[model samples]
Target: MEPALDDIWREVHLDGLKPVLPLFPTDALSEQSDESELLPDYAESDMNSAISALSGRHCVKLENLSISFGSVHKQPSWTMDPTALLDVLRQNPSLKTVTLRLPIPAVTVIEELGDLSRLERLEMRWWKDPGDTGTTGDGTTSMELFPSLRNIRSGKLSTFRRILSYMSTHLITWLKITVSSFSETQELFNMIQPCSALKSIHIMPIVPLAPTISDPLDLTLSFQPILKCKAMENFFIHTLNTVPPSDSDLTSLAVAWPKLSTFTWSSLSRYGPQATLEGLKTLSANCRSLRKLDIPIQVPPELPKQTPHAPFCDGVTVDIRQWRVDDAVDIDRFVGYLAPLAPRDGTPWLRLGNVKAGVWIAVGDRLRQCYD
Candidate 1:
């Protein structure tokens, strides 16, 4: 009976182990074992030293490298030696993307940057006072640093133009410029003409005229050069606390941009609804390529209550919208007049009311939903 019991136990153990035995290395049992063995301390140190050497030699293959400056309460500064950094960049030829946030001198920044050959994308944020000296010791502005850069996002228009002028020989596919004031619109427009490959342009705070209240009629009329850039397909302008142009001005723009597909205006309240609608009429007449249109309306209280008619657009789809504050309850009735202008599919025409503090939160929310 004891032999029978031992046989049964042996059978059960063999049955369980058989399923896992094939997973073990068959060579381990066949190969002759070596008598020499490594000590754990030496093995670990050797492994660590080998890893360090390999890492030092092949560090350039990393996909993402971020260089950040600035602390909680202090403005950012790039304190590295520009010449040494340039040398490191030249050695790390595999780097494809670069993000720079620093306070280095613009001349040094540009000089070191011109050496990166494989770089495809670049994002840089540097501050310069308007009164600072303009040229490097080599007579090159900060713009010569990046000849291959394609996309640019900047807080100051002057810096953007400076970069654009340097890269005028290269064709940029996308450009976005944001400025707090409209004082540099002419200069910005002048620099934009040479970029013939520009497909999309967004001009925020479009100042048709400077913001000096002293000259209420101080509108500047020097956008003809930009209007002639036939390559422009998408144009967006956002104006806050600035006057809107007259009907003639809109008419001129429409005739100038015959290829424009998307045109948008935000926070435009310099004129009454009559002037706005008249300007829209002019745009529809001239811009035969317009497909998407956004216009914010600020109707005056004294204007006679009347229906808004569909503005004329020749064979092109258009979306005309009015945005007003909640307190302006009288504007709701005017919605009916503008309802006819809504796209037959219920998309082109949008009516938004009850804006808060000149920020069209409700309109923005709805717009986001439509795009989503």
Candidate 2:
């Protein structure tokens, strides 16, 4: 097989060999170790050979390219030098997406990829290194290098920041970031404030592996900065710590994103910044395009006091946590009175109830299914 591979390389045409899956049949079983037999086999040498054979295909149009590097025993060893990646990109002028894993020394050299005028999406994953500072310099970040980029997903917060630091905010429409541990969320919002074209953002903050205290750290989460990105359609802020928003916060959000269709503000029910029914009403009234609303609400004692009107709309959804469980306020009677006011159509179909089985179980179920 080695002699045949050498013979094939010697017969390359002027346009170079066309790229194909390098792992031939029967070779997969031989490549895996006893412990790794259950895992998908990777043929690094074969891939490199195939890439080398196609090096001359300068006009090849590839849609996606995935490259990884690390110790073969402890990690997947698909490591290629950034320069080699650049060479591949240069050869494939029509490349649109690149997914990279692990760290590439002097990765900033990738800035040369500005030559790939058609590149649009860049995804980097499994970066656990905290000391790797690629191109996060003090200089102003300019997205001109990857002007065509629309979506970016990064596993490391530092890596995400380093890449986004140089990108023009207007070119990015979608960003999904998972950070290891951060003291606060203020810095994140500050960094993303310039992203005028951002439409959807999903941020997940993980706990730090090493902590100074034995107890869980308390962190503050704020979404006020998101108001600047008026083009936003969906914003998911998931955190391990509870950070709820207040009625005023929701009103501010309503004003900020009048076009918001889907939103998830975590810890609203069990945490701080608790909102009232009025805030939800304000959100529904302002976000005319809103279809689904999920938040934590403190069921007010005043709910039974309000007049219950009949349905107003045909299709809207609302999900909330019934934070308060008061025996005085009968769940059935309370929901019965508010059902009329809980209209569908332009109105949201509110899913409100407590986390545990409460008296409102039957009422909440009816509310969630009433729109149907």
Candidate 3:
């Protein structure tokens, strides 16, 4: 509709180019081959036309624009030609939010994005390649690409490391990224260690989010670098596999982020060295803003004589079903220490799957009495 409504405020959404089916079957594929046909076909995107339409519309109102060529249902095969939407992007220099579901564009395209100093949010599907950073002979990636970006979502953790290398990103608020390897995650933490203005972070998977790694993920040690972001509010990590944090690890996290509203480690089930009742109590005591806490924890062998605090927030909920409690723990006393799991609506959330449901029922009963 660029022919009719060429205003700066008009939002544009276009379906990107489609992927082509492979001529060769799986059996014909070779691991050693470096053929372009072996690569996933990327959405060339509808930008070819959208760019032509908006090439002359230099309006400051186009704040949100979305262009895609790829889909999760039909995965692509073959490499992408660098982006062709440079002219359209140049015309709308003030675009604040841009979502390009295209493959990694040439850094030249990134460098030439007209004065996007106002760009606040940028989401790219495959901007994961930390492309040719050694473009400068001295191997410095100090390019001022997105100086004013506040929210960014990319496919790779290494890409963020490249972005955050020289960015004075104090205004950054929300960040989402997909990670594939353990070492990549460790290196990503290096970049995130200094940029503390971030509030919410979502660490997702590339596609079909599942447990692909076989090595034991040391979540406790990995969590150390994140503790540097003291302003963290909502944090989530999804790999479906992790080692339960020890009591010390939990305590360190409780002390690190006082404003932690939501914390999640999306694991199917975790075992070994989980937080005890004391660790849960410590978390509730310190993180008064907590609304949701998802972890694997256990009950104490014997109940403490001192009374625990009430639920820190109004509608706090917890899912700690992946746990093993002490056999000698008293149900009556063990129930009181679990006041933090109390939901605001007076009903407890029990996701028990045959791991002592009776004891959990008693725990829920105590939560009701505490919240009431």
Candidate 4:
């Protein structure tokens, strides 16, 4: 015998009663029933209705919500209605974090999003075509709309610049920008300056559109503005196809970022070992606040029989040594040289060195303890 819809609704509405409500009509409530459930085809109107239904539902106050739009479904025409969504959010002040991966135009929605005063964290990716500037209705660029945004991950330099400009006027605490072309590098440095609260920056390299013949010295000057940001404590730069500048260039960087505590450089060798080592020395000298260092140290085919005397400065305690040597003999000799340099206080020291069979491992465990 099948249950009547009104009877089922009465049972569900009973106080303290919890029922397994199915979206589809079912004739039987028997466990393991084979009837296929049918869900109403979702539509724009259905979504709007659901939002309306949940508006006053006090239980709907969400701390975090993630929305992912499917690529197959035709985007609802009303999905572009940011004003309506903003009003709903304004009504529900408890919403704290929102992550959206949808097709709605970012710039249009961002302007409406500024009203989310209670929002603490937001992640937005602008994948839509930033419409032609010549278009009559496009009021402002996407950057202007997201002035209050503290974090962003974008695919284009133009978009990054727009966001950077906004942050300069307002204030941003953290920023991440990925560049697809080397030509965009200078513009990135120039734009990053205004973010006074910026604490960390990560640069992932893109292939150069065309190689420029700027002198290595000029390359150092180009990066000075980025190092000038006072709030930056951690910095990382990685390049794909482009050859890295010389040690002199890195020295210039160390000089510029005197307050840097953590620094990482991942770049292919375009210069010789001497230059690389010289750059590292300069970095060590300039970055007095440095506590962590991750730099590639290239080993030459033949190393000097005697280890070089690289004296440690006063008041320095922690030392982490990472070697990129390829040969076992060179690694052995390098470790032998560094063992004595380890601070006697036994602070944490990390070493990545090549051993037999070309495997790299940390052989500094005992040495680290000895320093402690």
> TM-score: which candidate is best?
3
TM-score of 3: 0.73
> For residues 218-314, what per-residue lDDT tens digits would candidate 1 score against the true structure?
2335555566566677877665544455566667767767777777655454444333656766676667677766655434455445454564453
Model 1, global lDDT: 0.48
Alpha carbon lDDT at 243, candidate 3:
70
RMSD of each: 16.2, 8.7, 10.4, 10.2
Q: Could you tell me every candidate's TM-score relative to the true structure?
A: 0.60, 0.68, 0.73, 0.62
**What number of backbone clashes does candidate 4 have, counting pairs of residues 3 or more apart or in separate chains?**
4
Query: For candidate 2, lDDT tens digit of each residue in 1-372?
Result: 442321222111111122323222133334442422221333544444444544544435355665544432244434434444456667666668776664453245446555767778877765444356543322265455676888888766666666665566667788888755444355567667777888888877654334334433233244556678988888887664454666887788888888888777664223444776677677777887777766665555444454444442346576555344454245564455446557645355546554345665666565665444
- Model 3: per-residue Cα lDDT over 110-155, one tens digit each: 5654267778887766553646453212113456556678898876
Residue-wise C-alpha lDDT for candidate 4, range 1-372, written one tens digit per residue? 654432221111100011211232223433534222311223433443333433333323344444433332233333444444455555554545655544456555454555555555555443354652422222233444343356555544554554343323225555566676565666677666655666777876434333334522134556766766776778777653344446876676676677777776655535332334456567667777766666655444554454444533333432223335556556555555445444444454444633455433334443443344
Return the candidate ranking by lDDT, descending: 3, 2, 4, 1
**Best by the lDDT measure:** 3
TM-score of candidate 4 against the unseen true structure: 0.62
Off by over 4 Å in 1: 1-66, 70-74, 77-88, 92-97, 117-121, 128-147, 204-211, 215-222, 239-241, 267-275, 281-291, 298-322, 327-329, 351-372
Q: Model 2, stretches more than 4 Å misplaced?
A: 1-59, 67-84, 128-143, 207-221, 268-273, 301-303, 306-314, 321-341, 344-361, 364-372
Q: Which ten residues in a row have the lowest lDDT in candidate 2?
A: 7-16
Give the Å shift of residue 192 in candidate 2.
Answer: 0.6
